[model samples]
Target chain A: MSWARPLVLGRLVRLAWLLPLAAVGLFTLISLAPIDPVQAYVGDRTALVGSDQRAAIAAAWGLDRPATERFGAWLGGVAQGDLGRSITYDAPVSEVIARRVPASLALIGTAFVTSFVVGTGLGIAAATARGGVGDRILRSLAVVLSASPGFWIAILLIAVFAIALGWLPSCCAAPPGLTLAEVGIGDRLRHLVLPVATLSVVGTAPLILHTRQRLVVFLDGPAAQHLRAHGLTERRIAFGAGLRHAVGPALNLHLAGAGELFGGSVLAETVFAWPGLGQATARAATGADAPLLMGIGLSTLLLVFCGNLAADIAARIADPRLRHPRP
Target chain B: MTLRARDVGLSFAHPGTHPDHAPTRALEGISFDVAPGEVLGIAGSSGAGKSLIAAALAGILPPAALLDGGITLNGTPPSPRDIALAPQRLDALDPLATLGRQIRRLGGRRTDPAALLARVGLTARVARAYPHSLSGGMARRALLATALAGGAAWVVVDEPTVGLDPEAADRVMALLRALAEEGRGLVVISHDLPRLARIATRVLVLQDGRAVETAPAAAFAGDGTGLATAFARRLWQAQIEDPAC
Candidate 1:
């Protein structure tokens, strides 16, 4: 089959099935919950009063219908870029997401880039220095970072750097307050440090260890021996040939790690008081804000999908054999 | 240009001696030379140091082999680019790379792989195909193309036609002759004496890590009691008589 057809069709199939399934499952669970959506929104079950008042409120939000009908309506609204209204904020779900997404994107984007660059570089170094003191040091550091909880690390970092050293502001530091240009690059980066570092430290360990292990394995394979015999320099064989072969698996790990980053960032955001999706999701969950909760879930799903897609594209580029049958 | 291994002695040292597990003496006092434009075929039983001699000549013997002699190419130390060996196995080529690229790499030629493939009796279409995709004979030919592409003065070809059909073997033998005629020295290592006799100018018989006989191809055949017949007889006796006894 032609490449383009499979690529487009695969994505289309994922969107066609997965979105509806997620929406239906989420809507059903929200509907069946013991907490009343009206009470959850208004903070008073008694305000949803007489039979007429209850019917009007339910009708306005299509909650008066059967479960299946309500789910279908929600799915249809999603198709038209309407993610429904926030039961708590009384705003459009898309508007809330749009307002909040930039903060989360910026935070996650910085964290992702930092983790990949630092982690991959360290992994290569560790693999090259396998069985040496450098490898031992890196392995120990990776184990420690990987084992520590993101919240604990965040708190320790805040205590040491923010409270003790007074190197950065403790909490709720506005991006513009420390900048002359409304949002100076330095100010943004400084504000991003604690959260990004927390996420990177937590996320980087597995990546470093995975890349290092994969590199060592590739070096031991027959392909490496053949390359060595071809009169290629050892450096060329190791970094050029070996690294290229190991990238596919490393990239898959990277994508999976990126998905986990969203979940892990909740603690970091909560500790740092960073106004990102994880914090938003946590607050919405505590208050039983179903629409906001669903909004966060949908955005997280989209981020994961995009990350996996990027990894697939990278794999195809790195090894054309993935796209074409070996012949 | 000539390729020579002078009094080459290679031994593997063992920490403790056991009668059944003695240190292997792969090559011992081996001395031979391949003159320009000559095909020197070495025939030996397995563990007779045929491969060790080949590795010594190509300057690729393992560190554990422990050489106590000298190998030279045109009176100078062997450089990596000076020697090329068509390994015994056909899939010796990289599975990830195209046959043409491999040929270009081996040939050390800046020419297109299609041109190189043409020299190996393969069409230009074969250039993009990988080694795994080729037939046994085709893979051998591609390997030969790689070895010959480097334009090396000498090639240490180990069993060039091992698993090939008669036709493929003939083609490969013919290609080696053409390479020899182009003033390149060829070392054809194989047990198939008939095939070697067809191409070699001189034939050497290696037994127990020593050159037991060295003669011109015509002399070896004219003697009527050739190395080929002798080796065959030994193999038959080992397979038939020794097993029964």
Candidate 2:
């Protein structure tokens, strides 16, 4: 029973090489683009410039060297925790990302937890009431939500909740002069309502459907019958037995979906004017700020990698069949 | 403790468009008693509800099947914890869990499983193996160990030696006899007349969900006057009559 070896080793090897390769490739392509950084800063590509000025600018940014030499310097800087300074922001790329990363991480983390809890609970309820009105209604809701595009759903929610109802501010406001710890739970929840709800509602459908399908299949298995025959309480059997068996596939999907949430949050931040990585990326992309763009891309890659890694570990923990193989 | 089923009947609801879709009776007016420390062997042809009786004694009848009469163990209805049943199919064991864990789950103790497995002629090494890693006989023995692990007052073993070599069957029957001598009631359900005679003290004959005869194990040994002989004679006559034995 030693199945975990090949799986862990294969994933580790891919992560060690493929991720660095992807990051290097992205850095190269963005650096070699035909756009001029000075013109991008000046907002006029045809603006006349002296050769000495261009040479000084190229030397200052280390772009005067060959592409290989430049990439090597950049890679070495990355290895030394320097990530280089953003030409547009005039600050360290790491510092800019560090300040905004927490906000985006908080938003996506809350959304992931909210979606997982609500979706799995609804799925179990629907499964227990299968072929009944509850199941039908749940199925209809899941299908509708799953088919609706996330951007459209986010717009619809904003229009109804923010514009029509006027319950909360439509965009980011001042933090109300409260420390992060001093912010009342209710007040924080009120502020987070739109973003968290939007993210969770858009992400919940697949999780709900997967959980319901897996639970129904598990209920039909021999282990379920064995538990029933053991005189375990129905509630215990449903949650303890049913959920334990169903958690593996549900978790894998949920974790994969959690990684996609970062991408969704980028769009969502742009739409809602939320101060997060997506907004920062949009600002950088609009200005063709290569350093800032690279920083955001690398940050997003890290988030996605961490999400998937957590998911793999959770799946292994949930499924003994995966952790141990027959000898 | 004694187990008694008084005129027990089980019927299944038939699904159809017809208005008069009465329930199909699987067992009808079946009455029998398994005394303490005695082995009662039930013999019947296929579809005679022999296994249903085992299920009833274990209090695990299917949801669709309705019980008509009472089934009492030790003068009370049987509870899941009090009775153990070994199903005919070895696939009932979970393929994912180790054999030791499955047995421990049933008994809720570690010591009993190893002892029970040893009693059923299984080695200590086999206890750690999965069901797929076991041979057919070893799987059956593991299943029996699981049944006996709970110190069940009565064990309803359904076709314990159905697909085993003669040596394995002897080992299983010897284990059952030993359990019976320890003052636990044993109900052995099988179609093998001679094997049942070897382990069973009393034999009960079932036909079409009805008990036709009850006699001592020796009654079927000499003359064909006992239930086993009568069951075989009925089968032979039915084959001669319909050619579908």
Candidate 3:
């Protein structure tokens, strides 16, 4: 099939509709909240401020305008490369987030790869050893971990490794370095250990469950038995024959969970004090920094959409069954 | 080489049963043999252990299946060099790969795919097609090609003619007959008796997991003249009763 035309059309349509609608959604959420943007910006008690002062602060922040006008202005400003000003930082929201994207991606990227490899490997092992003790153990562990919250795991890691064992740092992504470059790779990696562990633990569950379930269906079927009869080893039959079938579903489950993984990431980042977008978003929410919150929301949404696209491309590339057009 | 399964017994735990439940025997006292250059057809109704015997011979019995005896080729269990099975399910071929790569996976790095395809009555164009793209006959040929590439002494084919038209079935059986002519033993499992009678040197009748009777292919003729057992005669009688078979 010729995909070029549909691809261009899809890109144009999504850009035309999704960006504005998403912005409106975020703006509506922030505006409808009971908290005052003036009090949020001031970060102080309302009892200490005079009526004249509140009016001035509200006017300066455009909180005095109609909802439609404020959304239009915010969208226009964003289109012009201004993501509005951060009430908490007194800096442009984009600039604050720009400094944090690399850290968030690095943390998420490492955890993503680690969780994918370990979870998929364990799932394959469990599937091949179906009805065995190892399969039961891995399955039970995944069930328990899938239900466990990421923040709770983050706290447990800190209690055990950071505080109890005194083996690792508890926070701040590298001891509050003047610049990330100033911190040695060793220090960066050390700080990465806890956050990555927390994220990977939470991320691994869905992957394991999906892979195990999908793989068992494939491996226990006639195809696998046929492969065995042809002198293929169990590993060859499992990985070569079985993994090829298992990968598409597992990739879907993993990528589908990418959004939720990042959603839970904020808690891990906050508990560990990791200087990532998740922690930044958490702070933005608490401080009522609408601009920062909007910036993170759009960025996370974009990441999730991209993840979905990756899953689509991967499904086509990995399975010839999908590459052909269905009638 | 001679592939033989002697007094083979297999049992499976009844479905939805606890560990304490008695295992139901799916195959019992099943005995058969196929010599090189011979075509042996095992015939039975559905759930009659024909597939179970094939599974046992293929060394693919599941964990739940208990076996009392074993299969051997030339008095030893078939080695990687001894046998391969062409399964009924087309999915036996990896969907992710072209048919050529799978044949090569068995035949090794330097093997020419065109030659393998040619050996199985497939065109070189088929080498590039994925498993799902191939027609039923094409999928059956691909399985046959895989088995041939393994250089095994025997090939066990399960229900090769199940979904094929008459022309396609004849094409598949012709291919099997040719493989036997090349001195490779064949064990074919199917209920298509009339067709099996054409090529099989001997046929084994399985009922309730037991081999009730074994007879020469001639026994499957109109009235089952050479059939020794009443069960075998009834099976042959049913086919005789239905001309469509």
Which candidate, 1 or 3, has the higher DockQ?
3
The list of candidate 2 runs beyond 4 A from truth reads A1-7, A24-90, A173-189, A282-295, B43-48, B74-77, B89-142, B145-151, B162-166, B191-194, B203-245
Enumerate the chain B TM-scores of all models. 0.85, 0.90, 0.93
* TM-score of every model versus the real structure: 0.80, 0.78, 0.92
Decreasing TM-score order of the candidates: 3, 1, 2
- In angstroms, the error of model 2 at A316 is 3.1
> What fraction of the true interface does each of the listed models get right, in terms of native contacts kept?
0.12, 0.20, 0.75
> What is the Å distance of residue B64 in model 1 from its true position?
4.4
Give DockQ per model, in order.
0.26, 0.29, 0.65
Candidate achieving higher TM-score, 2 or 3: 3
DockQ value for model 3: 0.65
After superposing candidate 3 on the true structure, give the runs of residues whose Cα lies further than 4 Å from its correct spot.
A1-12, A45-48, B13-23, B226-230, B240-244
- CAPRI quality of model 2: acceptable
- Tell me the lDDT of candidate 3: 0.83
What TM-score does chain A reach in every model?
Answer: 0.84, 0.84, 0.93
**Model 3 Cα shift for residue B57 (angstroms):** 1.6
lDDT for each residue of candidate 2 in A191-265, tens digit (9 for 90 to 100): 677887777876789878888898887666655555455555667656765776566677788886665788788
